[model samples]
Target: MAEGRSIAERLSGAMERRDEAPNIALAEEIGASGDKAAVGELVELVRIGTARQRNDAMKVLYEIGARNPDLIGGYCPVFLEALGSRTNRQVWGAMQVLDSVAELRADEIAAELPRIIEAADRGSVIAKDRCTSLLTKLARSGYAEKAVPILVERLKTAAPNQFPTYAEQTASVVRPAEKPGLIETIRKRLETITQRAKRERMEKLLRKLNG
Candidate 1:
């Protein structure tokens, strides 16, 4: 970062670096400094920069969001639009940012559930993971009536390796009326989970939920 270079100019995209350390460091710096101006530049790069640059920009945006979601809450629409991006990195990165701010922007996010669900259904594992996190946040933030059923459906078909964690997260916000369905879902999936540790986790969750 040159003394006089703009924050955008100091990003990994402008520097043309291949590694992510610089981008991560820049994200940390911008997050710590609470530089709202850099967010606009990063969002622009995410929208129009080359693939590498877009990835770096998205990374920085989400990193900043992770530290203080309120700073990036207003950009929920940008993240939602990125769900339609053909780039897998951008799609998942957008999902990650959305997850970070989902609680703060729950109502806005709840309204975009269709697009969010569509992206998660076809996107990368990371995208799916973040989507689960996003939905969980929405459920916890008082949209459980709308988010939990969808979350339960996702849990039913979630990748076996990822099911336990998703189930655990969903459990936290499950309403009493939804618990039976969740218990049934977990019980049915338990047989297919070959890992003993994961099975025990699901079983424990079942026990906790049942009680």
Candidate 2:
């Protein structure tokens, strides 16, 4: 609130606020302004701030990325580094940012597939969800040959509640040669999916793929 207070000082952690509304409002403000300097400060905060500070910084960064990914596109390294963080919030927040910019920075993301996949394998549901989204985006952005197989692997092992959505998302990008394999994976999983809606959705996907 004081004049000349740095962006870091204004963050929720720095201000010692328990609520995230201020942080969300700040993210919207910074995102709308397209202030690269603020983005730089936020990135630095993610690197060296306290646990709460790091969380707030990541929240703001991803919110900015969501509004205008190009504004955060060049910070792929920062995001990648956050994947290795001890803090779960930082990891998932970074994944959200990476997902937002995956298509815009496809080459950079393609080069970091191993790290991304590793993070997804050990990460929370939100992190895995975003990784799935990132892979699908890459699959559509000329990396289908490399991304589709990984996507299929993820689909096979996805949580039953999430399988139908993952299957639906992967369906559009699958090549003809991949269809039968996907269909088979879906069919095998169908028995485990007790929810009528989900089973029906996967069955629908199978029908579409079969035609």
Clash list (residue pairs), candidate 1: none
> Judged by lDDT against the true structure, how good is candidate 2?
0.88
Each model's lDDT comes to 0.88, 0.88
Candidate maximizing TM-score: 2
Worst 10 residues of 1 by lDDT: 1-10
Worst lDDT run of 10 residues, candidate 2, spans 1-10
Question: In model 2, what lDDT does residue 169 have?
Answer: 86
Put down candidate 2 lDDT per residue, 1-211, tens digits, no spaces. Answer: 2247888788887887988876788788888878888888889889998788899999988988888898899999999999998788888999999999999999999999999999988899999999999999999999999898888888889998788888988898898778788888999999888888887888888888988
Q: All candidates: CA RMSD in angstroms?
A: 1.4, 1.4
lDDT of 1 by residue, 115-178 (tens): 9999998999999999999998999899999999988888989999899999999999898888
Q: Backbone clashes per model, in order?
A: 0, 0
Off by over 4 Å in 1: none
